[model samples]
Target: MTQALVDGTVIRGHGVASGHASDSPYPAGTIAMQQPYFAALGLDLTGLYLATINLDIQPAQWRLLQADYTFRALRWTDLHPPEDFSFIHCQLLWQAQRYAGYIYYPHPATKIQHFQSPRMLELVLPWIATISYGARARLIYRAEQIQIEPAALL
Candidate 1:
């Protein structure tokens, strides 16, 4: 039941709640909370897209990747998050384009009530508007780097 990453397709996520709460599509709180962490790790979030690109991966495929990636939840306050709150950094590829970003793990509270599929992958990038729904994309792990390309479909 595991689908190949190369065969994966990108779907519209309606964007994360954090993004919708702000003027821009990007998630302000989530990004703000993670900024210090990224800074401490010497990673820069300024160059990346602040919103998430939803990926529709098969359950089996998601399980396979979950086994390999580390899942960490960011809980700054007790308020129930409107979307997934966990994430892992990785690379992605789509239409011959490459990107570096993280795969967000939607919060269980939000997923059970909001998402239609259990096999959901959220990509948080600096240039998320590049890709639109129904685009073909792939997630790759090479040299510990995660790159996604064709960030915007249009």
Candidate 2:
């Protein structure tokens, strides 16, 4: 176990820029753990959520994460296409007042996702090399249940 202080708070984990397993295709890494851990720590994602990725070779860029967004959003575009991108390290910034979060220069191959419950969020992620980086790792999510009620008639 390792410990580090962030914003005066102590966080105990493996180390800097590590990964966590969440499912078959995603591996456990710092990039994959941030937001979900924040959510588990009680940070709400009901509003806008953004993750920024920077490459060692270029300036940083960001994207707003949506429910139906594709895998491309979390990937490092500049280093992608021919070469596989792997997240070497990153830093996260959050706007609690705006209900927004920012991930700066996430390592290549780092991925993030959202879930409604803590129980369902504990799954492990598979290794990207085995599955290939360009492949889309589909999240298995529970559909929201709808309730029906009697309507008032004239």
Give the top-scoring candidate (lDDT): 1
Q: Pick by TM-score: which candidate is best?
A: 1
Candidate 2 stretches greater than 4 Å from native: 1-26, 45-52, 55-154
Question: For each predicted model, how many residue pairs clash, with residues at least 3 apart or on different chains?
Answer: 21, 22
Tens-place lDDT digits, model 2, residues 1-154: 1211122111222222343334423244444444453455443333322222111111211222222212224322233232112111112222221111222322234433221111111112222223322222222121221111122210
Segments in model 1 whose C-alpha atoms lie over 4 Å from true places: 1-4, 21-29, 32-44, 64-73, 81-86, 106-116, 142-154
Sliding window of 10 residues with minimal summed lDDT for model 2: 115-124
Question: How does candidate 1 score on lDDT?
Answer: 0.54
TM-score of each: 0.58, 0.18
- Candidate 2 versus the native: TM-score? 0.18
